[model samples]
Target: MELPVVKYNRSHYIETDTGNKVSRKSVIYGSQNITLSGKTIIQAGCVIRGDLRRAGGGQTLVIAIGRYCLLGENSVIRPPHKTYKGVFSYYPMKIGDYVAIGENSIVEAANIGNHVQIGKNCIIGRFAIIKDGCRIEDHTVIAPNTVIPSFSVYSGSPGRLVGELPECAPEMYEARSKEFYSKFMAT
Candidate 1:
């Protein structure tokens, strides 16, 4: 899909050497625990809570956003936590390359694989695992601990398996993400 040109105020963002564009209006707490690989765009009003780390540990990585990813405006990317064997700890959240999370979404997934697209206003529950080439439709609510297989499309409140995607989904999604990044201009 071809995305329209979207422009932002130049002074409101910081463009890094590796093509990362981070909005100043975004709230990224405990930034030390968050990792942006390269060419990642984090839009305004986004909140990345990296302070929530694993117990009995140092300042380890909590959230890792892979290369060429997009975290849309007003979205929240938080690490998932739970009590495992009487020890409460926050698990690591990994979002693979070429992932695009739409606006106003709240994601607490443990692992989101490559070329995944999560639509607007979605809520990905804690510990949910989304495999490669998967698409979660808008307004969907993924159940906690749910595992979405590769090349699948999920939708609705419970985020059931809607359909399967073509084998070329990875290449298509990758192109889309790169195109979106290239068209993200500062005006």
Candidate 2:
């Protein structure tokens, strides 16, 4: 079935803080159910949907993107809880502050800590825990139900823990976030 079209009533185009523009043709549903806060960027051709089972369910899909998050073009983010038993449920995608994700990536995990970078075309498995100060390189496939501890970099098919990130310091993390906000966001 073809997806429904949504018109952006406020603006002609959806321009994110990271200088990413979600084309007007893109579909954004569950506006009443989905809440977007802080400075975040979501690119073009992306789909943001809420609960599918319950059309009138009062529960809204919570995708909390902390300050300075860059969701690349054509990315998809859904709530944590999966629908089973022929029923729709609500789950929260809790994202901490200062996270950057590359293009065409799929994130359905839980709690990506502060200052984490997930590369392009990557798939973050369910229940995979990515702690703070972690960097996932491009094209890395994070296996399902894997856990990555804090301050580490994992790059592989199953996402092995390589080591601590180069800039584990909180100061460096802040700096990088600022750079992303300025370099990519300000455009």
Candidate 3:
């Protein structure tokens, strides 16, 4: 399938044949440590920090982003950090497919499952595990080490389970993501 393209000043962000559109303005560190499956979009001003390797690491992957994912503008995705046995260490971050992270959000999650939508200006704390088919409302603040069940909607300062997602959430999310990608082209 042919992915869409978005236009910028003179330089355009083209979706590659593999279905990835990475903005030139985005900051990606340790590219070797970050794996993008395919059909992923990293918007302008987004910062993905893969440079922070694991403690006692010998060439380990830090960040893994799945296919059909969209990271909004100015968002920050980084591995969660903690002190282990008196030594500060950074763990890996895993994000699943068809996930959309809204603008200006900070994600330090250990795992974000497929078909998840995280709204703008949110803060996902370290080691937080967000299951599949979940929706995180805008400006929500998820506490550290929190575990969110699948097929649910979360919101608020401490991120509570506000509602549950429909059984067809995965299909709906897939369609929405594809549609968004298709319309992300420059006029």
Model 2 RMSD in angstroms:
7.7
Q: Candidate 3: where are CA atoms >4 Å away?
A: 1-10, 14-17, 55-57
Ranking the candidates on lDDT from highest down gives 1, 3, 2
Task: State candidate 2's TM-score.
Answer: 0.75
**Model 2 regions more than 4 Å off:** 1-12, 15-26, 52-56, 83-90, 166-169, 185-187
Instruction: Show where candidate 1 strays beyond 4 Å.
Output: none
Give lDDT per model, in order.
0.95, 0.67, 0.91
TM per prediction: 0.97, 0.75, 0.92
True-structure RMSD for candidate 3: 3.0
Residue lDDT tens for model 3, 1-187: 5445654452646556787988888999998999999989899999999999875747889999998899999999999999978989999999999999999999999999999999999999999999999999999999999999999899999899999989999999999888887767654
- Local lDDT at 167 for model 3: 94
- Write the number of the candidate with greater TM-score, choosing between 1 and 2: 1
Tell me which of candidates 2 and 3 scores higher on TM-score: 3
Each model's total of backbone clashes:
0, 1, 1
- Which pairs of residues collide in model 1? none
Which candidate leads in lDDT? 1
